[model samples]
Target: MGIAVTAPIILGLTLEHLEVGLALCFGAFWCSPSNVSGSLNHKMKGILLSALLIMVVSFFGGYLHYKTWLILPVLGFLTFGIAFISVYGFRASLISFSGLLALVLSFAHTSQELEIYQYALLIGVGGLWYLLLVVIWHYINPKAQTEEILAETFILTAKFLETRGQLVGQQTNREALQTKLLNLQSELVEHHATLRDILIQSRKSSGISYYKGKRLLVFVQLVEMLETAIANPVNYEKMDVLFKQHPGYINSFQDFIFEMAQQLRFIAEFGNDIKKLPKSKELSICFEKIKEEVGLLKTSEGKADYEDYLMLQNLLEYQEKQFNKIKKIKWLLGNPDMDAKDFIDRNESKRFIVSQDYNPKVLLRNLSFRSNIFKHSLRLAVTVMIGYVVGNFFAFQNPYWILLTIIVIMRPSYGLTKTRSKDRIIGTLIGGAIASGMVLLIQNPYIYGGLGVVSLIIAFSMVQRNYKASAAFITLSVVFIYAIIQPDITAVIQFRIIDTILGAALSFMSMLWLWPAWGFLEIGKNIETSVVANKDFLGKISHFYQHKGKVPTSYKLSRKTAFLETSNLNAAFQRMTQEPKSKQKHLDKIYELVELNHTFLSSLASLSSYIQFHPTTEASERFKMAITKIDDNLSQVITSLNGGKSQNMASTILQGDVFFKEQLAHEKLFLAQEDKHLERHDQEAHLVWEQLRWLYTISGSMLKLTSSIDFD
Candidate 1:
């Protein structure tokens, strides 16, 4: 509290009121931050860094007799350059913007130097008060943050599961869920980075059991599958049986997730109630069931280890209890969704055909952090503005004045840009108006004291509440200072309004004109690629279904092809949603493909997994060669499907058509000519021929669909 109280006074003496406005500008740049929640380590570093920067400016500005206002601009540019790498992109933004604001508002004023004792008391007191509030709030009730994050993760997982359930060949909707799932990687990244912030109790966070990690990994794998299906439509026949069985075996998995969600809400309702803890072994039971099912079905090459399995199971149990405790109330029934088969069922759907010989591993794409060209351009433009302006202003050197600067820059997506811009303008305008009015009233000391107290209350309340509200109070504080001290209201209001409006206008225009956001065309192109790939995947599947004897790998290749296509579609659709509202309707239409793609792929994955697991053990070579041929054809089809614009894909296709195989290769098949004993040939050959004809018909229809969509 003492530190909080003294902070402003020291600031006024050392920076805002510096003899040269230039030195004050540097100090002001350092002073204006809303520094509450940063790591104690980071905050200490910030303090040291700011002091060092100020000292540099003071030496030159004081010796050169440069005004604080003018010299401050130089410090702003210099600080941004020096701190950009160290501070990180967003923090650097704050420092850079603050410096520019000081220069813009430069007025002739000199600050008196503060004694060391006074300086220590002011900053130290103010900071301590804020720190106490933060520490208490965090420690007294800490579970809320963790529960909220868990809820978010669960919901996201549920959405992906929904998408996976619909992938190619088994359902009405293909790739319908792809778009939504693509955003998972970004969210995952954010969650990973701020795990500590999301969960207050470090000990409890570490308690997460092994099963929980595996479950998360499973979810990640599911998303990977969803993305692939979107990129290329998969052939269901080639899919492993597990994919098909999953939809049924794990029916309404999301409902179970939803049950877990109930705890998330309770934190608010009961304030960390103890009774709410999934007081029973329900989560443990759930994990046990999951493990049992995995074992029965032979998941992940029929060899999921007990160690990892049990660990994951324990983690789930732990989360269940923690999740319940967060809400504060107890639920007697727990989850009604828990059922008999959820624990016991092994999918009766078609099984896989594991070969005696080894099979190759499947590799799904991973999340990447590639640099975006457009973002780079935007960053450059913002930096240029910070540099050019600071090259100009300086008056009596006062660094603390930097704290008063108010300018904003932002992107429309995060809600930061609009909120900051509005507050910056409103606070400046209103503050100036009040300042103009205050100078006349400053003659009375009681009135001045009362006003200061009111300002303090507003600052505390606003600081505890929202950023914009806090900024508003800060603006008022600045006005109060000038008005009570100078006793001139009208001129202050006029100039303050002018400066704020200018800053806001400049920011808006710059963001609007430079490297503007892209529109729907790019999104459309991306969707087209996915759709086409899916179509091609369907064609290969058609081929596999028709030709069963020779090429065994046809079905497997088809599923993989589908997975790749699905990936591309999901990514494109995800990108589209972040666009402005005007582009949303079209993007939504395209995003629907994500769900469709997911359904298709899961079915295919199930089939592929099943086949890989349970290969009909007869002659190995004959079947293997046939499978290889089919796989080759599928690879070519996938390549053709993904050919974005103009691709000459003739050479990439199967060398000789199946229809022409007997004719071109001179293979002998027992055939009865139109006059051959009037259909008296052997029944087996006749049956085989009829079956073959039906397969070709189905295959032809699929090919037509696959080749239909042209990306361009």
Candidate 2:
């Protein structure tokens, strides 16, 4: 904001009108709020990339505006390329920034044949000014931004944990809890992506000290564990039954989880100076009480009760491990010199090299009709062409605003497009009113400039956090820029309001009718993808166990991919909820499918957690058969999702296989012998059997879920 407002004002004194102001404001907008963090080198690279792209886009955009004949094909191709490459991370950010700047600049400037070069240069200059400001900002405190972003990641995780704790309450609304969890999952996915970038940047950065670098590496490990630990939390209803007589234990357990979250948040807040933080003794005490409660129930319990007790034991142990992990992170935060290489290597660490993949083959693959990017690109092209022609015919004061709005507002889905349209319209009206009132009351140029600067800063800060607020401030800043040029602010506000509504309407209609992609149809594919990812992850874990050596790179990659795909699936489910009920066919089946997948993953995590403790344990043939059957069932389920025949073949794999019954009989015989020998229950044996039971349950759940869906 300082650079945007000050550079323009500083140059405006020498230049003619507020053209420099508009150019600088947009230049700053396109360059600000970068995902790349840490070193000045990376920051400058991002800024220069944006500037170069802006220049090229601006040059071609000028011609497309002048020669109406070329607008459709040229802009359509650009849209297709930009939208297709956006599937890769970080590329979308730069592409949108360049595209928006070019669209706005080319139309706003009345380009003369010889002055076209000057126009592109002006845009580059504006971007360079922003780059300079950003470089200066980075040097001021290079580590501060990364630290703040890391803090936000922790805070968001805490919020997600707190929401999960709410699910444990007996009186809570199940649907509401599920909805909140989905929203939190979506948000956490976004935060994880941002944090991944920060970690990647820090790893590549030569700017920070070795202490800071290792700390960043440890943080990366910490966040990855966080995802797994919380992935499939204990069922609240089961816990409720376990604590039927003593609900206080349930409350204490919930509070303990919440306290653990608070400790994480404190670590985020205190950073490297965490000595003053209060230790959480409540969790330890609660664990003891729960232990006592379980012991008391043991005397009156049956075999089922004993099984529940074992499950509870596992749950308490896992929670304790998580708590200790948090404490360990806090310790690492304070003592950054501690050797973290082993911890990092165990996860198969890789260096972060940030670069865009503009390979021709990748782009060509995405051009297929089946690609969502291709469909979205075609939709955007049609909408923009229509919007531009209509705006030119009507001769709105700022006709480019219509094109810009359509570009920003039109998403691939109706739900997103409608949501954006509402936010855009509401934000525009509020901004227009605020700007008009400000112009009426304040006549001082300096004050107007200052407020605009502040508004820009606020908007940048809130862009990722809150879009509606960001939009409002964006409107105010843009209007202030116009106010500096035009005497009558009313006309500017009126034109902005009308242009926004028109653009939003066009975008909404286009998304609703043009290449419409219904959520239900796409959701099945997401489910299949998630299942495949989970299967790969499980296979990798099994290989790791059998090898009994260093954890393989495939294990880590599969784990990350599985979680990422799950997040994507969750996002699709959330979007499906937002679409019209009529369009949301088999909603219950989709919901059930998602829930079953989550449950299956969590069960896998439970198995993996045990394997982490006993990596050398040989798998029984029974366990192997169960996994094989589950894998086969997953394949069948995927085929069914893709509209294949159901085959009506019930998987009696678990039901007919005598492995589980034989295992249970063997355990009983062993326990009977142990009773005679006055021995305790075998912990490792119990864990293996528990995991086997969970696999069987997941298999049954999958079968039920597949039955619920209608492929026809």
Candidate 3:
């Protein structure tokens, strides 16, 4: 907003050139969403690179303007190439977007420009102005980004804690609570990515203060502690069974969680300026109450099952340690001089890394019409050309509107395209109505121009956050600007609305009927990938156990990949649900698959958490065999799903061996002995049993999924 208001004044740019500059600003802003607190140097470099690309695209677009026949083919290929390359990553995608927009804008106004290079130069200058404003804003409010990060981290942690509180009750919907927890974990993973960016920026840039770096380090440590707590959250269902006879203890535990959540919210509110840590004795009291309840059970005539007692004891001890960690974190937050440097260990984040073969030969070898991105690019090219030809045939006042609408509204997936189509139409109608009213009543050019700038500022600001609102404001800004230059807006608004609708309908139709990428169609492949990743993760887990629970980087990476792949599978299914009925396939089975995948991961996570705390060298031979069998079954299932030559093991894997159940029962009997004490490996063995049970269920689910599909 500040950039839009002051860039022209600062750079002495004329309003005509400012429009080009504003376009560059808008492109840069859209490209780098959620990066307000990122390093000024990176931000500036990105915009400058985007600006240069735009200049080159614009220059070539202008040079090719006179060749009327080449325009469609050239622009089509340009759009196709740019959109296809977006398969790489966000930064690369944004750079591609800038180039595409440059081509579009240059193609539109090429005939009017006497010197094409000057117009391209003006666009570059405009990008530079926006870059300057962003840099200045970062320097002026250096702590704002760090503060935002802390606030988000704490808020998410609070929400997760709240979910944990809810899950403590037997009456709670475990599936729903589990879903919410998984979502929160995904959000935390996203936060970790953002924090890594901030840390990297701090390391490279002197603009960040030492105090700020130290503070971020402390928050990073706090986040890691929170992660450990959230990730290893007790299987509430198990806790419910343990506490069913003593609801009082559960209530007290809930109270502690509630207080902890409140404490986190307060920290979020204070951020770096916390005067003193919010005091809370509720957790301590709750801990004592739980201990008392457990003691009473031990003294009762109807003695509690020793295995249950051991489980409860382990949980309570974990909670006590977690409580102390939270209090210590609060104390550190309150003391600004605490040595967080020693505790800050930044893990390299791979959350947003999309692996793509950039080598031309490799890309060419892999390239085919079957690629979704390639097909999407082709669809876009055809749609844009159709829009252009249709508009020109109809003698529309602005043929470019039709092309622009197609460029902005089309997506690879039917669901996204359908959504954007609605937003574009609704936003255009509203903006047109408002602009028409203002144009009919007001004749002041200055007022109209100011309103235009204000609308432009708002549009750019909200573009990343809310596309519908941004579209409306962008429409209003464009209309007002047109009104200032060309006063007759009745025809303009009518043309704008009609052109937008036409283009949107075309784009939507294209996405729906032209090489549409239905998630459900590819869900089998997604499931296969997920199963393979989880298999690798299970292998790593097995290796960790074999090596006395040492978590190497490779194990962590495999775990991360498994979780991320599951999340992706979940997302694909979710997107499929929102799509048209025609796009939704194998609905019930897909839902079950997604649920099973989620449960599988959560179950493994529970086991992993316990194994980390208590290294177990005594995992029974049967337990190891169970995991190996599950891994083999997973590979077989993936092969079946992919239509490879594999025999159906549905009946084979569905039937669990008595050995696993016997081993688990034996462990329980040993733990239940009156004089037997709680051993570390005993708890580990129990968790292994629990995880095996989940894997058995997952195997059954895989059988059901494969049965439902007609792979033959």
Highest TM-score: give the candidate number.
2
RMSD of 1: 15.0
- Can you write out model 2's per-residue Cα lDDT over 459-506, one digit (the tens) per residue? 878766677777789899878877877888898889999999999999
In candidate 1, residue 575 scores what lDDT?
Answer: 50
Query: For candidate 3, lDDT tens digit of each residue in 21-118?
Result: 44445444433332344455556666777777776676677676554466778878878876776665555566666676666666455434346676
**lDDT, candidate 1, 221-280, per-residue tens:** 333333333333334443324335454333333333344444333322432344454443
Candidate 3 lDDT score relative to the true structure: 0.70
| lDDT (Cα atoms) of all candidates against the true structure | 0.40, 0.70, 0.70
lDDT of 3 at 52: 74
Clash count list over all predictions: 127, 0, 0
By TM-score, is 1 or 3 better?
Answer: 3
RMSD in angstroms, candidate 2?
A: 3.4
Q: Which 10-residue span in candidate 2 carries the lowest summed lDDT?
A: 345-354
- Pairs with steric clashes in candidate 2: none
